[model samples]
Target: MKIIVLTSWLILSVSIAFSNAYMPLKDTELESIASQFPPLEYLNPLDDGGLLQPFLIVRIPGTENSTKVQNHVNDFFIKQISQGQNSSSSEIPMWKVTHDSFQDSTPIGDNITFTNICVSRDPELAINEGDKARTRKRLTLAAHYDSKLYPEGFIGAIDSAVPCAILMYVAKVIDKALTRKQAFLNENGVGNENNQLGLQILFLDGEEAFHEWTSTDSIYGARHLAARMENEDIENVDGLIGSGLSSIDTFVLLDLLGAANPRIPSYFSETHDLYNSMRSIQKRGRNIKGLFQHKRRESNFFSSPSVSENVHFLGGTLGDDHTPFWQRGVPVLHLIPNKFPPQWHHLTDDVDHLDLRTVHDWAIIIAAFTAEYLELTNFILDQ
Candidate 1:
């Protein structure tokens, strides 16, 4: 009789604990994670004529200098996993580079090639009847590391440097979190293992236009890669997520970050739900100093969040790296400031003018949105 009573109490305790622990993400927590990125000094180019030396995602076939730059970016993500403090180091991801060539009527040539960089962790194969079964879904986080050209100089810190740096740290934090989770499961030997979705980071190339934004001009790398992925024979491929073009669950793109109270207006008709979900996540995090402490406040998910309705966007639409994927009907979440910063596209945009708080806020929003999408709130709580 005593054993039965104890078992019932234990089960009830476990249920209650799980329920109580699943809390929404906090700003302070995300800020700490965002701090993992190096300071502004390391984010920009050498502040000379060197921008074109390496940032020429515009030139035909790209350049070895830019490839070296791409590799330099990849090295940061790799280093965090290899030398991360207070996190498991096993199962570090590798960057998958695919050199894509496309036809371009440029002054230099017609056939232009650009290299795309991808980093992702393969999901553990499902066990079913002594054979591999379904593979877990994938969530992609993308940012264009390559910048447009300028006659004088285009460091483009706000143009893309902020987003790229934020993603670098986001990858680092998520990698550490995932490794820690795997280690936890290893030690405890408990819980359903396949309850998580895999993460894929895509740092695209050739996002900016060599000349102007045309149906065929901008997003050269994105266009080629998306078309290529769509054409691949999925049947022959093993672990192609779930579907070929449909393998990706959501492709969230970040741009024009690191400004004070930046506006993020929704554009795409399909991404309304996803955008709302993200907005709700941001709303929940900005409630108060300690709103989460009160159980009552937790219910108010989106109470008076940040907004700047007076600010206008570019034709109520945006042309960015996600255009190619969105053309294929892939769900895209475009996180760009509604009011494009004053220093946009000009030489004035640099690390000295960027706002760290806004950058930190962006990191928080992106990470929190991803965690919610993957249903990892409990994971946050568990930690």
Candidate 2:
């Protein structure tokens, strides 16, 4: 993704209201969720079935390695999640997978095909209710899986490989909690009225520019998918009509992470409260033993939410996959460091340079944040 400076006028003119309440997890609850799954199973490079390995290759759009990475994502949702279930049994709740594929011209003088993979875990009542599914709001986590094309054998570990792996880990850790919540709702017969929220993960393609960064060359998959969602109308309920993009409660995009001692800032004012909530979660995680392995660092990954009135004049926001959706009025939380890692866009940005402790810490913090955002603390604790 390319970094474009935000104009002061544009930043000041934007107004959005976010009204979601965040319920913080207890110390024991955070420890329970963090310990449910192996922290380094997905981020470790030595693990053969890990999520980061397939992404550690040169996976440009319309290439063989790109397809391999896409297959790896699909297999996780299908085979890994569906383990021990019979073919015809619906005992386990599965993620509904969909794809948005298209062809577009790039600066490289070729039309490349890009596909965006989306998987969701909607409530059972929403699935059975069919047309009323639009009433369910989605909390989306996204990261681009495509690598840069300029430098040969560039892996983009911190550029986005670690971000993608972190998303996968979030999905895996929250699956059981989501299932338990669904069962509780069904047992109580609350239907979709109680919790009309779901989880969606997107693995985007063609995020890197072919040559120089331009408006049309960068974020090809995001541009197409955002436009398509804008056209599709949501089913009206209570005389309220909205597009598919409006169904999103918040769009959280992760990029340029997994490096040590990185500082992330709150880019948008609308989601500043949510950013603070994440910072609180990270603080709670630091107290948990064996969670944060680094002993010397006492600072947090996120910067203080307080900022000067002239923050926008100092190039506050960035141009990335979230730009397309944010332009259409979706509440976005951009979780990239204020200053990028030392290996940004370099050929040395590989698995060897990533900090394992930082990688595992991110997996814990993000998973805990997802649980709190979805209001799954009670169900997660019951498990």
Model 2, C-alpha of 89: deviation from truth (Å): 4.6
Query: Candidate 1, TM-score vs. the true structure?
Result: 0.71
Deviating ranges (above 4 Å) for candidate 2: 6-19, 85-93, 126-132, 191-194, 236-239, 295-297, 305-316
Clash count list over all predictions: 1, 0
Error of 1 at 262 (Å): 1.3
- Please, what are the lDDT tens digits per residue for candidate 1 over residues 1-383? 00011221111111000111113455554434435432332334443222212332332237665667676565555553446354334432333333444554543457666777777664333223222334444667787776666534666676676677666655554554555555565455544433335667787777776665565667767777788877754431134333344656667787777655576676544455566676665565555443222224332222223332332322224567776676666766677765677877776776667665555556656666665554454344324
What is the Cα-based lDDT of residue 8 in candidate 1?
A: 17
Which candidate gets the maximum lDDT versus the true structure?
2
Encode model 2's per-residue lDDT on 53-106: one tens digit a residue: 778888888888988988988889877865654524545356878878889999
* lDDT for each candidate structure: 0.54, 0.78
- TM-score per prediction, in order, is 0.71, 0.91
Cα-based RMSD of candidate 2: 2.7
Q: How does residue 207 of candidate 2 score in lDDT?
A: 89
Candidate 2 lDDT for residue 285? 74
Quick one: best TM-score, which candidate?
2
Single out the weakest 10-residue window by summed lDDT for candidate 1.
Answer: 11-20
